[model samples]
Target chain A: MQAILQLLVSGVLLGGVYALGALGLNLIFGVAKVVNFAHGEFLMLGMFAAYWLMTLTGINPYLGAPIIGAAFFLVGLAFYAGLMRFTIYKPELTQVFATLGLSILLQNAALVAWSADYRTIQIMPAGWESIQVLGAYVPTNRLVAFLYAVAILLAVLVFLRSTFIGRAIEAVSQDLVAARLMGIDPDRVFLMTFGLGIAITGVAGGVLMPSFYAFPSVGSFFVLVAFVVVVLGGLGSIAGTILGGLLLGLVETGIGYVAPDLKEATHFVLLILLLAVRPHGLLGVKGAEKETLK
Target chain B: MIEIRDLHAGYGDTEVLQGIDLDVRAGEVVAIVGANGVGKTTLLRTIAGLIAPSRGSITAEGEAIGGLGAHRVVERGIVMVPEGRRLFPRMTVRRNLEIGAYAARARPRLKQSLEEVYALFPILREREDQLGGTLSGGQQQMCAIGRGLMALPSVLMLDEVSLGLAPIAVKRVYEAVRAIRDRGLTLIIVEQNVGQALKVADRAYVIQGGRVVLSGTGRELTNNEDVRRAYLGLTEHA
Candidate 1:
């Protein structure tokens, strides 16, 4: 019974981190209607950014997440203005290829800039590394990341519900042509969505850096986890991302308890099963995936 | 007041509108009636700046707004409630209406405009919390119109509003049209239902092959032989 409880606690914490990482991808997809293939690469850069900020400025990553978020927001805007603008309205294939190219470019850039060495930050003091809760041990790093995830999820929900620009993003996602008729410039909405989405993803990466290793190919692993979380949760759904993340986390952890070697394989396996069975996801509207790129 | 002269527009290499000329006075309810694919909707789209005019000019309140995009044209008070009642399907009815005030000019008057829209369509107020896609066709039309009104546009263009609605729904929609006309706002409507459109319009143009084949008061077009035969399905002898 204690073993089961331990797995559950670890799963929930890991799920929160996954939710944070995928929220940015979902937000960008929801509004911009483009699957940003470079999403994982952006997260990779975020981890590197966090590492450098701490190395150079002596400010810890937990303290520097907002700064990283703000800087990545500009990178997102430049990404939209410089590259995404041209392919946004084009065929879905064009967007897919464009982002895929960006992903490869960013990965190779990371490889050259930092090498393939795995890096992890040590922030927890000697005795405070893990905490016991209900007889289950929880890593302090995972707990902190989970709190950040919860806070951000609430913030995103409020932003969508109460703000003008957030509602405009929602408006554009539903109908691009109609949004235009409502006097919304699709370009401006796209730019803001990308910025905000990347900002969140950057924060998530910075928050997760302590618990996970930072490497060039780290994005590949995270990208799969994030995509599965998004697909399981619901396309374009913020709250659904949380649910999906938790479910995937529990499933992967439960499976890992039985076979540790196959834990990494669950993301791919579950994504395929979910796609074949319910592509619309738990909260997504039907046919949303089919129409986004067209 | 708005005017379009020798306007030509179409989707990439396929010209749908060919040198169309139109005039709409303030507080006038003008109907542009024609068959499907006859460029009636295209004309409204061009005037609303959804499409650029390949040739000719559009002037609204004496300002030349020939090639300005829809976002810019909206600041000048031209708004469109596109066909199919293109409400943000996932957004609540209230949120959809609020989005109508997205234009810079409409933002300041959001509260008053919301009141006006609610007063115009009480059902929208009732369905305020519901997602737009869940509404019935007639209700969606009302929601779409309410959203357009939220923009506080001087000239409101409705394209194919009566397309998929039932007869009673169409009548209710026209009643709202009458009320809007009485409120002294310019209305440019493109409706497939020729009989219903002509009854509500002050003046109308019968478009054919992208040009205004006939223009007259509502009653005159309703009585004209060509318009009667072509649009109303009536012959001189039948």
Candidate 2:
């Protein structure tokens, strides 16, 4: 029973990181209807940024998150303005290829610059790596990442509900034609959404640096995890994302406990089954998936 | 005041509005009536800057705005309540109304405009917290028009206000239109429901094949023999 409880706690903590990683991708996809194939690359860049911030300036990643977030916001703006603007109105294939090309470019660029070295940050001092909760041991870094993820997600929800610009973003996400009639420039909204999405990812990357490795190819792994979370959560639904991540985290941790080698296989198997059974996801609006990709 | 001279516009490769000309003065309820597929919608869409004019001049208060985008057109004081209510279905009524005032021009008067919209559609106020999609068709139309008003438009345009509604709901919308006109805002209404549109319009234009076939006061056109024969589907003096 203690074993099961420990697994559950670990799963929930892990799910928090997954949720944070997927949040930005979900936001970009929800508002802009762009699948953002390069999302993983952005995460990779974020990890590198956090790594360098710590290595060069000796600032803890958690403490340096604001700087990372602000920088990534600008990177996101440049990504949209310099590349996405041209292909935003094109066919879905065009967007897919465009972002895919960007992903490849970024991956290669990181490979050239940082090489294939795997790096990790030891932020917590000696003998303080794990914390006790409910008579179970949990890593301090994972717990901190989990708290940050939940807090940021809640903050995003509040902003969307309360602010004028946030409401405009929601309006555009719902109906572009209606939003235009209401005097919203969809282009501006798209630009802002891209920036905001990437900015969140940067923060997620920074927070996860202590627990995870900072390697160029690491983003590819997390991106797949993010896709699973997003697909399970429901496309374009923030609250659904949290649910999806938590569910996946628990399932993966349970699978890991039973058969460690088959752990990675569970994500694809579950994703395929979920897609077949509930393509709209756990809480996605019906037909939204079709509307966005098509 | 607005003027469209020799407007020519269409979707890619297919011309819809060809050589269309129109003039709408301030404080006039002008109805553009036509059969389905006769370019009535195309004209309004072009005027709203959703469709760029291929070869024409659209002057609003003497400033050319023919190829301006929809957002820019709204800044020029034109707001369109589209064919369908087109409300953000998931958003609350209050959010929908608030979004309508998103234009820079309307943001300053958001409080006043919101109060007026709520005053005009008291049902909207009562259901302010309800999602837009949950409203009945009649109530949706009222909410849509109310949203347009929230933009603080000098010239408000409504496309097919009576598209799908019961007779009582139609009457309610007409009464709202009367009240809006009484408030002294310029309006350009396009309708296939000739009777209701004519009842409320101060001036009327009969469009056929993207051309203005006739123009006169609402009462005059309502009684015109040609208008009766063509649009009203009435047989010439049997």
Question: TM-scores for all candidates?
Answer: 0.98, 0.98
lDDT measured at residue B109 in model 2 versus the true structure, 0 to 100: 94
Tell me the interface RMSD of every candidate, in Å. 0.7, 0.6
Candidate 1 local lDDT, B125-146, one digit each (tens): 9999999999999999999999
* Candidate 2 residue lDDT tens string, A2-44: 9988999999999989999999999988888889889999998
Task: Please give the lDDT score at residue A220 for candidate 1.
Answer: 88
- Model 1: CA > 4 A from native: none
- Per-residue CA lDDT of model 1 for A199-234, tens digit only, reads 998899999998889999899889999999999999
Task: At residue B238, give the lDDT of candidate 1.
Answer: 69
* Model 2 chain A: lowest-lDDT 10 consecutive positions: A285-294
C-alpha RMSD values across all candidates: 1.3, 1.4
